[model samples]
Target: MRPGIIDRYILRYFLGTYFLVLILILLIAIVFDISEKIEDFITRGATPREIIFDYYLNFIVYYGNMFTSMIVFISTIFFTSMLTNRTEIVAILTGGMSFRRLMVPYFIGTATIALLSMALAHYIIPISNVRRLHFENLYINQNTGERYSDIHRQIKPGHLIYLENYNPDRKSGYRFTYEVFDGQKLLSKLSSDFIRYDTLTGTWRLDNYTIRVIGTDGDKLVIGRQKDTLLEFKPDELSPSLYSVTMMNTPRLLEFIRAERIRGSEKVNMYLIELHQRTAWPFATVILVLIAVSISSQKRRGGMGFNIALGLALCVTYIFFQRVSVVFSTNGNLSPLAALWLPNLLFAIIGAFLYRIAPK
Candidate 1:
């Protein structure tokens, strides 16, 4: 349906204010980030152009999506409070437009933002994170060492690999073992003192290795000084940092989660939380818009300040609850779906309650 004049007016103001607020918040974040990292950039001899285009460009996208819900709430509160002050909302309501009907344009505006946010979270952000994270690791973290220890994984069905220590820089491992199993029965085992990945040959070179084959009759053992073998796993897959999940887009993330589960990784819960959060975080935009309109639509004695303060308070509470729930999911036995979504669900109910009693 073609939008009427009132709907168009409200949508135009809402979108204009939303983009303005988003830009302002991102600018403030970039300023603070530069302040904190200026010394590192200077010490690393990072040029201004590189800093602007390479670092802050990706930085803005990351934090912009990160804080979209807060921006939505603030924008909605600011614009709706202005409408209340000007008595535009009162005029519309007096003209037989119900408060529920007034929400149509707001919902449309928020849905647009929410869809954009979801797309960014699931696809664009992760691709940008590759460069952002690489830049930070080289210039900011500056800690280059072994990222994984005592690693174990099932690279494929019935094939297990273990490493006592892995050095990502050298692409080598010490005390490596590979095992093959058949329905809870050991088929064969390969142990090596040291294993180095031969990038030229795309294979693994095992030094001072021993292999044992198990059969119905007995175990057959073989020893060798050096050997080269093809393996299903790669060095990169074996040594991922805790934050590696953030670098994967949705499809890669799903594949990683499946592999991690097969490898019996305890950190799979964190990945699951991240997966659920991509969608859940964006959906909060709608909830926050409803809450903001409910709280800010009626002009009070304290005027816009009162409504803005209340909205900020609620936003803070929402963030606090979200963090607490994530901690529960990560540390406790809480389900990731429940932990990531509980805040949105609770606030949605609050929005409904406020909507019920909001001034028409």
Candidate 2:
């Protein structure tokens, strides 16, 4: 059976209205944000072009990607409710078209949105985030003095690394430790109380260091006064930074997870959670879209106002669950995959139940 021109018209209207409202709301948000931060940019000696094109432009796109799920839900609710209110949905349902068939176009549109969101979040917007964070650091000066703490973890195969203190400003760490293990045995350990990088040499220098080598029967602890080790890692790479976490692509994230797991590091939970959340979050857009469509397809006495309120309540509840589940995962109480996706599972179930009972 062929869908009439009216069906195509309704699809275009629904999708166009959805994008138009979303862009308008986001524009208003950007204006308010720019007004508030304009002074800070000026005080920091930022140029007008930099303020407008560099920062705020990327800011809007980043935020839009972050709240794409909300946009999908609100758009679905608004357009579906409008159709029901005008009796278009009723007419289509009564004219030999099943509700399932009527939902095909909606599903197609939402699936496209979800795929785009997934691609941007995982690949594209993250590149913009690097520049955005740099703008904040340079012009905003948000992280001038706030340096990252030293990370002491195993980096290479059978080698354990440590840093006593790390400063992002200096791009170096102090008091580093590197050790190697061989078949449930201690092979060699390098300890340094002061690990400083030589800008001229482009390498790290170890002051007042010691090398301890374990023998077959007895271990010999060798002490050295000063030395330079040719390790492959840098201080800034090991130190924690906001952008350092977000800058990692999916493959880099997976590599970090694997390395951290081998070293038995406890702080790797957040990285693992973020890696899984990126994929899991896109599916949520689809889930929320289904729920919104089902809830708003029936005309109520309160009309669109009632549907908006209902949609807000559901969206808020979903966000709350998502945050709570993340907390559980961070605390290691729940598996990363399970915690990240628990919100989608519960809401998808609710969507299914509502769909079954929705007005035909």
All models, RMSD in angstroms: 2.3, 2.4
| Distance from true location, Cα of 37 in model 1, Å | 1.7
What lDDT does each candidate get? 0.91, 0.79
Model 2, which residues run further than 4 Å from truth?
147-150, 216-225
User: What is the TM-score of each predicted model, taking all chains together?
Assistant: 0.92, 0.91
Hey, what RMSD does candidate 2 come out at? 2.4
Tens-digit lDDT track of model 1 for 199-286: 9999999999999999999999999999999988887788665467888999999998898888766688888998999999999999
Model 2, residue 315: C-alpha shift (Å): 0.2
